[model samples]
Target chain A: AQRVTQPEKLLSVFKGAPVELKCNYSYSGSPELFWYVQYSRQRLQLLLRHISRESIKGFTADLNKGETSFHLKKPFAQEEDSAMYYCALSLMDSSYKLIFGSGTRLLVRP
Target chain B: EAGVTQFPSHSVIEKGQTVTLRCDPISGHDNLYWYRRVMGKEIKFLLHFVKESKQDESGMPNNRFLAERTGGTYSTLKVQPAELEDSGVYFCASSLSKAGGSYYNEQFFGPGTRLTVL
Candidate 1:
């Protein structure tokens, strides 16, 4: 039962507000987590991976093995940050296939 | 370098009709993958190709779907007698294959082809 779950279908927030997009997973093996973003008219791009431990565009995610979560968080939301966010999981093995969550749409209002 | 590209950005075909989708991965990338996303569902992997050989195709749904990557270059996915459930956006991705590395090879995605089965 390997799966990724994004609880919020849509998260609306005003500019300068803190934003959090929840993501949880259920896996039996070592997990490699990633957050991908898709802006309007743009292709999907990797935002950050837990392994990198680096922030991208002021956003960050922390992998909690005990909670089985890798929630994406940003201190302040910007209009440009509005997009579809997907959380993906892959095994630490040789396989490259990704298991994606249903995704969440974040709308940052002015 | 050009990213992965998919042909026929949009396709509309009736049920029982056939449709072929093409993808050209980024040059020099040896790993190519196909994914599909139905309405309201998460994207699911359909297959993977390492050059001209299929590295894994456990996600392919059925026999009506066939994928081929000839000459270890461009690839094609053909759906014969497509059903309503086959309607979705098909995505192609590519990444450089690495040997024994901790750096996660990031996968670049194409714009994707939206297929409609009426």
Candidate 2:
């Protein structure tokens, strides 16, 4: 079975401070990880993926296979960055079903 | 192009009532997926469809839920005799078929339909 764990339910930080959202997974095969975000009143949208190695909105995440983790990070968080972040794992099976972690809500205060 | 769309943005019904939710994926997408997020829980996958065929349904919670994609263009999820625990937001997503590469396409999600069972 594939499982994702997000230990934090709510994280708060002052504006311009660094932010890190932790995520860990348990999968039998090589994991495909992704981060999805939902801003207030907006639909859930993809933020980034491990394989893409790309940063969006100044956020970057490195997949640490040894740690079985994919933690999202940003050098400096913005108020707009506040959102519900979910870590997801795509199973190795043919269908590539996504298993999502319980989300962490980030609140950026001015 | 239009993004994925789901009908009946919100529905409220009593327990044991039957409700049908609809999803319209982006045109030309071949892979469609269904997911739900119950109150205070993570978004959970319910099923997937490759074209018109059901590819995976391992996440469906019980027999009271039925999902179908007739022409591969759109899909529907029916919950008959819904329970109080069935209240949640149902989301639909779609992606282009896998291109020849190590990376698969990103899925675009709909706004989701919020269902409330009293």
Candidate 3:
């Protein structure tokens, strides 16, 4: 079965502190992973994709096929970075359907 | 450029009642998808529409849920004899048509409709 797992329900960090939100997946085929963020009063939006290999909003995630992880990392966290993060897996069949994890709430304290 | 929109941001109804949720995708987007998030659970896919056609609906929970996209435009999801387990946040997303054979596009999501069952 294909599934995405986010171990932490809430991850707290102080401003300027390092932040890491863990995500793991179980799939037999090549997986396409994505990180989505939803801020207060905002719609869920794509933060980054493993395919892009780019950083957005000072956050980056690298896909490790051996470990089956796509953990999101940021060297310095900001107050605005506090939001609900979800790791999702896209089906390889090109259906464009996303399978999401339980999600992790990152709260950056001042 | 408007984003995807869902009607009735919140709805409270008793069990066994019927509710219809509407979703209007961004103008010109051909791929529309429906997802639901139960409390403390992952956001799960419900269905997918490609221009008035049900491209994939394997994610739909059961026969009680029916989704339709008339004229390849806006879509509607109707739940008959709703149950308590149906209560959750329903999200609608839209993306552009696939280019070549790769499906690499951002799916614009709506504000989502929160359904509550009494």
Q: In terms of TM-score, how similar is model 3 to the real structure?
A: 0.98
Write one digit per residue (lDDT tens) for candidate 2, span A1-110.
Answer: 78999999999999999999999999988899999999998988999999999999999999999999999999899999999999999886768778999999999999
Clashing pairs in 1: none
Ten-residue stretch with the least lDDT total in model 1 chain B: B96-105
Candidate 2: tens digits of C-alpha lDDT, residues B20-60: 99999999999999999999999999999999999999889
Best by TM-score: 3
Q: Lowest-scoring 10 consecutive residues by lDDT in candidate 2 chain A?
A: A90-99
Interface Cα root-mean-square deviation for all models: 1.2, 1.1, 1.0
TM-score of each: 0.98, 0.98, 0.98
**Residue B2 lDDT, candidate 2, scale 0-100:** 74
User: Candidate 1 regions off by >4 Å?
Assistant: none
Indicate the worst ten consecutive residues by lDDT in candidate 3 chain B: B98-107
Model 3 spans > 4 angstroms off: none
Q: Could you tell me which 10 consecutive residues in candidate 1 chain A have the lowest summed lDDT? A: A90-99
DockQ of candidate 1, scored on C-alphas against the true complex (2 decimals): 0.76
